[model samples]
Target: MIEVRQVTKRYGTKTVVDALDFTAKPGQVTGFLGPNGAGKSTTMRMIIGLDAPTSGSVTVNGKRYAEHAAPLHEIGALLEAKSVHPGRSAYSHLWGLAQTNGIPRRRVDEVIELAGLTSVARKRVGAFSLGMGQRLGIAAALLGDPAVVMLDEPVNGLDPEGVLWVRNLLSGLAAEGRTVMLSSHLMSETALIADHLVVIGRGRLLADTSVEALVQEAGIGAGIRVGSDAAERLRQVLAGPGVSVASSADGELEVSGLSAREVGEIANRNNIPLYELSSRAVSLEEAFMELTRDAVEYGKVAA
Candidate 1:
């Protein structure tokens, strides 16, 4: 487990990350999400103690990272893959970390195999492809056999197979009751992997909740489509309570909030929709957009 207590960071006079508080629990993958210059990196740096917080505090398990007796065994992080020495082989690099941390040298080979870098373990890291470098970085993170894993953009450069491999690896780690916190701007990938989401905007907490709760809170329910006079009638029936009704580009009624089942119930109850009725939930991408739309610090203007 990890706890961030009112953490804040500043560079000069600009506050990059404001007072934010959240907890990352074990047995789940928590996604850290934000747009460009939204302080995602700064916050992550604070979490790992790479950058000191101007105020507040962050702890791995129950203590600051530097204070932990065996930091690697407590928390293993892949904040940036390029941090490794280019000239060193993947095997040697991990060996060095294991040696310094008093971890068994045998763990290096295990991580190499776990990350699918066994074939290139002896090759210089600089010569490896971007995907290979990412795998090597992951291998280093797992070398300590830590309880908490933090990965920043773990899939930044990888083939489809590598991407799937990473997803499975995160799930497998979390299933074993280890805390896994991964940061990524890719909502689709996060949606598929994370059980919880910790979204930040302009360095402040936007949402800290489960994926299912976020989808429900975003009101992404099945959409209703109707074109007959029943359209207006069905609209009225769906309008009550928490539902939202709108017209699609094709002139079909789009209803959110009520499920297809409930929409069909109302339609059948009113002899209305005989056209189209299907379950339609808003994807994680759409929900993330809605959540962070107001928090983007910068964006390109329309041409």
Candidate 2:
């Protein structure tokens, strides 16, 4: 597990992260989300000890990342995929990393196959495509089979198949009871993979909750759709103090403050014939936008 307690980071006179506190537990995928310039990268850097925190502390599995004798075995991270030497081959780069912290060469080979880089394992790093580089980075991250894995934008250059592979890979890692924390701008993918979320805005913690809880709290694009021949009558019947009913251009009733069952029961009680009643699915992207609307640094103005 990764624990960040009251951590803060400042660069000169500017504060990048402020008193942030959150935990990424084992057996779950935790998504780190925020808008641009929200200190996500700074916070991740602090966690892996790339950048020191100005105050508070960050620990990986009960100790600082640097405190572990075999840091690679404790935590594996991919902060930047293109940080490797251009002269080295993919296999050579991973082999070098394996040598450090006493990781064996066999494990390096295994990760290469796992990351689908076996065909290009001997290719020079500089000649690899963006997707290939991402695969290599992921292979390096899994090199030590660390108990905790952290990645920033893991699917940045991946194609559809590669994206699906990454989703499955992260899920499988978490299933093995490892702590998995990733930051991504893709909300749809994050929603599909992450069980929990730690949302930050301007370096402060906005939410640390489950995916279901966050979507429910946002309460946008959530309601029952009522289709009936007597749509106007059904709307009036369902209307109450806390309830809201809106008519669509197609003569469907968009209802809030009541479940489908309640609406159906109310309509049945009033002898209103209903043709269709279904709940509208809430989009994760919509909820994300709602939660971070105020926190957006470069929001666009209305035309």
Candidate 3:
């Protein structure tokens, strides 16, 4: 439901987002991710028409966000927290927003409940915690019941329970055939919530594919640890071209560049008894770190 075409953004002489092209489709949760200062916020702002693109354009459902007659009804965006005025109560704040968008009062109540803000709907926003403020912002976004919802770091200040709530909420929204796009720096959260991932590095599209595809394509070399009297022999047998073997102090070996089945076969053929044989693919975090290793601008020194 959302499309970005050659969207570029620059600041002064430096380009922050360069020729970005992608699509956020209905019925899927697209996770937008990148390292610090990777232009995620800028892109989100451009999508909602809060900021002008340097060259290209972004459209929601065939028209620029600003060009739509009922923009709030077409796209709901939560770019930052504390968007609500601190002086107003949560109910009044959403009331104003709903009114501004020509939405009915019932919509305001619907969103308040949807956002789990009924308990404190009459409280001033300034008294709310960061998480509460975030909830209020989300309520405002849902007031329009837009076809497309764009959230930038929706789980920033949420507790574990609140984070889980958002995860399920976004998944539910997408299941109903609405377009959902949110930028997050939390790999673990994205791994659990996102069906597809759009990875950016240095303001460029690093990888735009499903989370499963990224892990599979990385071919995370299987990790095998064995405890046996034949540990030395197993290491010797595993050492060769295409195979890498490293010995651990626990009298075990870490093997990579081969599958678990291959390792078992080699051990069996060589008459090496293995006390443990298991496998695991790379974590989403590791895969992402590997993908953006080159994009890292800072590094820690070895002690």
Best by lDDT: 2
Compared with the true structure, all predictions reach lDDT values of: 0.87, 0.92, 0.87
Q: 1 or 3: which has the higher TM-score?
A: 3
lDDT of 1 by residue, 1-303 (tens): 989999889899999999989999999999988888888888778877889999999999999998987789999998889888999999889999999899997888789999998888999989989889899888888888999999999998999999999999999999999999999877889999999999999989999998888877675454655555567677777788788989878767877767777778877887774677755666788888888898888976889
lDDT per residue, candidate 3, 1-303, as tens digits? 999999999999999999998899999999998888778888888998989999988999999999998888999888877876788999998888878889999988898888888999998899999888888888877878999999988898999889989999999999999999988888899999898899887788999999999987775674666666888888888888988888778867788887888889989999888888777567788888889888764456689
Superposed on all Cα atoms, model 1 deviates from the true structure by an RMSD in Å of 2.8
Which runs of model 1 end up more than 4 angstroms from their true locations? 220-223, 227-251, 256-266
Please, what is the TM-score per model? 0.90, 0.95, 0.94
- Alpha-carbon lDDT of model 3: 0.87
Candidate 3: give its CA RMSD in angstroms. Answer: 1.8
Q: After superposition, how far is residue 270 of candidate 2 from its true place, in Å?
A: 1.2
Model 2's alpha-carbon lDDT is: 0.92
Model 3 regions lying over 4 Å from their true place:
297-303
